[model samples]
Target: MNLAERLRRALDAPAPEDLLAGDLIEGASVTDGIVPAAVLVAITRRAEPGVLLTVRREHLRTHAGQVAFPGGRIDPEDQHAAAAALREAEEEIGLPASAVTLWGSADPYRTVTGYEVTPVLGAVDPDLPLSPHEAEVADWFEAPLAFLLDPANQRAIEAEFRGRMRTYYQIDWEGRRIWGATAAMLVNLSRRLNAWS
Candidate 1:
């Protein structure tokens, strides 16, 4: 089967188990105040498929300088998760909503930062004109989809957060670090794709 067919089957499959930041939280509850967010997980249609990612601007109040998918809070005007994801992707990375051919959305994942993020998976032409919004995105790059889907690339790392040890998954592509909710979502996607394969 082709890449699009594979992704379509995976997305059409049963909802996967939720992977939450709560797994890393040591003591206190982590799901008190939840905000709705969505991300565009765009797979570049190229000789070797690649996943689009962005390095958030350092000056941003939240998740500054972190590697993230093009996404943000679901606005009141947005109709659904995929709509919000597409809007955010356009606003942040100059990726036109028309350029994305969405396969489907995955099971939502919660982040330690209090956002319940729905990951919208799609495919886009790699040659599409893309320019990062200077204020929101420091830079953008594409990581190979094969590299990201490999279970061996996922690593669990622990760190002290708010005086408690927290564990999270991280995947390093070259020197770019993908972790937190983004990494968790990718892990979930990997499982779905692997199962369908």
Candidate 2:
């Protein structure tokens, strides 16, 4: 089967137990209302597929200079999570919504920042030219799908957040650190796909 079909099938299956992960996994608590957000997990169509990611501009107030998927809070006009993801991708990276073939969405991940993010999986052409939104995206690159999905590459690390010891996942690629909610979502995706395999 093609990559899209395989991914869709895997995502469609019942998610394995403990599949949901985020800041809460590390003993963080959120007393505020959960904000709805969506991210595009854009898998490239190539001999060796890659996942497109972005490094936010340093000027951003929150999560500045961090590696992240192209996405943001779901706007009221958005019909669904998929639409929000596509819209965010277009606004953040200049990747047209039409360029992505929607597969489906994985389980939602709750961030310590109070965002309940839905990861929208999609397939896109690897060769498509992209223009990064200078205001939000400092840089953009594609990390190999194999590397991101591999269990061994997902590292568990600890640090003190808000004066409490916390553990989270991190994936280092070429020099970039993909961690936090992004890393957790990738780990969740790997689990779902591996479960099907």
Candidate with the greatest lDDT versus the true structure:
2
Model 2: weakest 10-residue lDDT segment is 20-29
lDDT of each: 0.87, 0.90
Clashing pairs in 1: none
Q: Which residue runs of candidate 1 sit more than 4 Å off their true CA positions? A: 16-24
lDDT of 1 by residue, 1-197 (tens): 65546866888887545434334377767656788999999998887789999999999988999999999999999999999999999999999999999888987887777888999999899867899998999999999988987889999899988788888889999999998888888888887877767
lDDT of 2 at 137: 98
* Candidates' RMSD to native: 1.7, 1.4
Query: Least accurate stretch of 10 residues (summed lDDT) in model 1?
Result: 15-24
lDDT of 2 at 133: 98
TM-score of each: 0.93, 0.95
